[model samples]
Target: MYWPNCGKGYLGPGGLDNYGKYFNCTGGVAGYIDRAVFGNHMYKHPPCQKLYENKVYYDPEGILGTLTSILMVYLGVQAGRILNTYVNVRDKVIRWTTWGVVTGLLGGALCTFSRDNGPIPLNKQLWSLSFVLVTSGMAFVVQAFLFMIVDILRKWGGRPFFYPGMNPIILYVGHEIMRDTFPFAWKPTTETHATYLFMNLWGTFLWVAFSIFLYKRNLFLTI
Candidate 1:
């Protein structure tokens, strides 16, 4: 793959693997953002709470995000156990999650498209969940494609690793671009909900497309 200087310039199959390894091992994506924005660049980026403020509801924007934050923490402990094979979770809920996601995406999109030029509400309790599931699914798709990339590269004996430095840097760079470029220019400043909504959707589709492309080429990241 031809390399570009900026993260945005990264393209083709191996790029995702190039980043996944670094971010996967470090504080995941969030920590990488901290280092990229704080350690390497000027002006620390806004807090996640600030950047992803849920406007429609008072949840995270008020005491809700805090509440969910606690639950997320709890889930982390449980997740560790599950990944280590300490316990196997039943697929009952997650099995139905895809349907929920499709509904949410369709509903959210419909509502979004119907609205005129204005700021959308955050509704973290409702919408943020959509963001999480959608992105998580997208990430998995990306990983799958990266896996294929690695498989083919091995035929020629070129080994590549998904580094531990890529996730946050990519997110930070993407967020910064959104904040600076205003890709969704029609979105008003007060419409934080709409901003996040569209950006995430864009990210989701972009990553999914990337994954599909890589998968077709048999280029995947080797974890």
Candidate 2:
């Protein structure tokens, strides 16, 4: 019962609003009830089924989800700015890494407390918030470490290299290492990774070398 209040593209995934848009919302997002996702599937949620016929799909008390998303996004962007503003590799790297790990922990905590339309109701905002928090947090950490590595190694032409993020080197080589090496690893077969949570973790490793080059020579990838 995930009725999206946002019009146009934000109206949930596979909906008419976002069919061809670049951003692809998955079947499941953080804090959103099982109904928002699994209602289209066979996920067994009696509460969601019972509420599906109602005019309003989401819980009446679910406004907190949007608020939480706003807060997480704000905090994440500020955290990114703090890390990016630093000139020193050590300070920049440490701050970003800490932000990434800490935000991930917070997102995990939300999962523990979230329920599918029980006394507690999860919604789109919470799901989107968790994504932003986790992504930005991980970005901070990865950027720091990558910066440190590039600072140590002087091969990247004193500038950052920001392209080929999901190139064969990463998507093919790195992922095989995860699948063949890690025991019982839930590696992604077609998607980013089965452990979708690690998307930023891997993304950081791929782009840090380039980012450090950018930082060292004052080059940035801007639109």
- Which candidate comes out best when scored by TM-score? 2
On lDDT, the leading prediction is 2
lDDT of 1 by residue, 140-204 (tens): 33433443445433542222123212233543454566553433223445546567677766755
CA displacement after TM-score superposition, residue 14 of candidate 2 (Å):
13
Task: Give candidate 1 regions above 4 Å deviation.
Answer: 1-59, 87-165, 180-200, 203-223
**CA lDDT, every model vs. true structure:** 0.37, 0.46
Instruction: Report the lDDT tens digits of candidate 2 across residue range 37-120.
Output: 444443333222231221223432234445666776687677668756877766766677777788866654544435332222
TM-score computed on alpha carbons, candidate 2? 0.36
What overall lDDT, based on C-alpha atoms, would model 2 receive against the true structure?
Answer: 0.46
